[model samples]
Target: MALFTNIARIQDGLLLCSDSDEEADYTKYQNYAKQLFQKLEAMEQKIDKFSIEESEFTYHYYIANGVCYLGFFKKNYPYRAVFAYLKELEEEFRRIYNQQEIEEANRSFTFIKFESVIRNLRQKYTDDSSLADKNIQQLSENLTDVQRIITKNIKEVLERGEKLETLNLASSKLSNESKVYAIKARNFKWRMWWKTYSPLIIIAAIVFLVLFIKFFIW
Candidate 1:
């Protein structure tokens, strides 16, 4: 079980950089995380802090100085510890990298070197023993109340992006099925036309033949 699933830097409603836990299944969680990130971006103007709850995990995020820091943790994990870890990450990131460098980056995971820091911090926080440590307890006490932070469920977080993907997929499937149905309908119509008109044409041909025999052959 990975404690921290992802870390990202977002600015001006765009994801500037990101890193993910390699040991975990990236495919399974990336969409969920991405959806949450988008939600954070949408809500950034209204609120600077919040948590998004999913079935198996929770996304905690903090935005400051035009940079957003996000983290993913299991639902049972301590909320204070999660935020504390993120705060530490933000401070370290600011200390090491300047704002201009982050803003100018044009690609995902532009600060790929930061993954090493993320891994080290994840190990320290994931350990059960750290929860009982006096320093951690003090840190939790000093942290802000978890209730004060805005909370949104997974459906609400995914309401836009994930829903759009699902809708697009359904639409594509319907389009293909509609094409098939159209072909079937056209074939059915052709069959009906042949059934209704073929016998009349045969009778007409026979009548023409009889007329020719009487008028010319006789």
Candidate 2:
């Protein structure tokens, strides 16, 4: 069963719109969603789509055109189905909200009108009808091996948010070290070549000098 769906701008981690399910108390999950958005923001667009498992719920998300479409579902729900749901939402969102509107928005829920579209699509996939199930199976197969998608526990994700800056600094240090190693390797190669060929080069020069004296000076 679908629990909730939220769409946000990936660049600034600002909510754009979502399904307004009034019956469920999703406050806890909403907090986690906020932290997850921060994690995504720090990731610098490394991963666009993924899932996180916490308690008995799983969040499946997809990022396209700088917007992230994410949803929540029961742990037993076919994660593939959630991904299919996100894909449909992405298309509907792009059709309704142009690039300029998506980029220019300065506040959350700028296009709250998309909530109705989200509610309808969520129902379409989560329904128990045979056709809906079959459609989920077929459409989601294209997103093959979603089970292999990066799934992390809530603790790891939240804690890693603090460590992302350190990781980035370490990455920059490693890159600089790599460049130094490359320069050293090139110098070592040139030195070995000089050591191997210097004797032959010196002999060639001596022979040319001797020939000049024998033919011309003598």
Candidate 3:
């Protein structure tokens, strides 16, 4: 059985809708998904599909057209099935909402009404054993490419301590002036090294040329 599923905007990690996983104490997994949102937001190029493996569960997420569909499922659950579910959810979401609606929304879970659809789809894929088997087969025969998608350990990913765009966004803030200054300082150091040593290098080259001409040519 699935634990949780949600849809969010990749641009800013806004919660558009989340499935209701009743009676499941999946707050920890939900937090992982939220962290991924923040991590994915500043990425210039996002992963189209990926999974994070945890102890008891694995998180599957897919991105398309600036939207992200994420799900947390049992560790034994088929990755192909999970990705297929996400793709279907993404398609249905696109059918109901356009890019403008997704972008212009100000509040979290603005499309709470869409939660029903999410729950229905999750049930359709998870509850029925036969359907899940068939879907996994279809995914294997098609271009799901779940095998090639990147999968990272959740603990290692969290321990990496946000070495992301803008150089460790978590160490300070989003627009961390420190990193910017660090880059500038590096560039300046290289320029100063050249400025100071360039004269010595030129003099050495001239002396070598003169010595060579005096000895060999003259």
At residue 92, candidate 3 shows an lDDT of 90
Off by over 4 Å in 3: 44-46, 127-152, 162-218
Q: What is the lDDT of every predicted structure here?
A: 0.57, 0.67, 0.67
lDDT of 1 by residue, 1-218 (tens): 13454545544345554656666765555676665555444444555455666677876666667677777777655555565566667777788889888778777667878878777766755543243455444534543333342334566535544322211111223223324433433454566678889999999999999999999999
Could you tell me the lDDT of residue 218 within candidate 1? Answer: 100
TM, every model: 0.59, 0.65, 0.64
> Which regions of candidate 2 deviate over 4 angstroms?
128-152, 162-218
Clashing residue pairs, backbone N/CA/C < 3 A, model 1: none
Model 1: how far residue 64 lies from native, Å: 1.5
The positional error of residue 10 in candidate 3, measured at the CA in angstroms, is 1.1
Q: Candidate 1, which segments miss by more than 4 Å at Cα?
A: 12-17, 127-152, 160-218
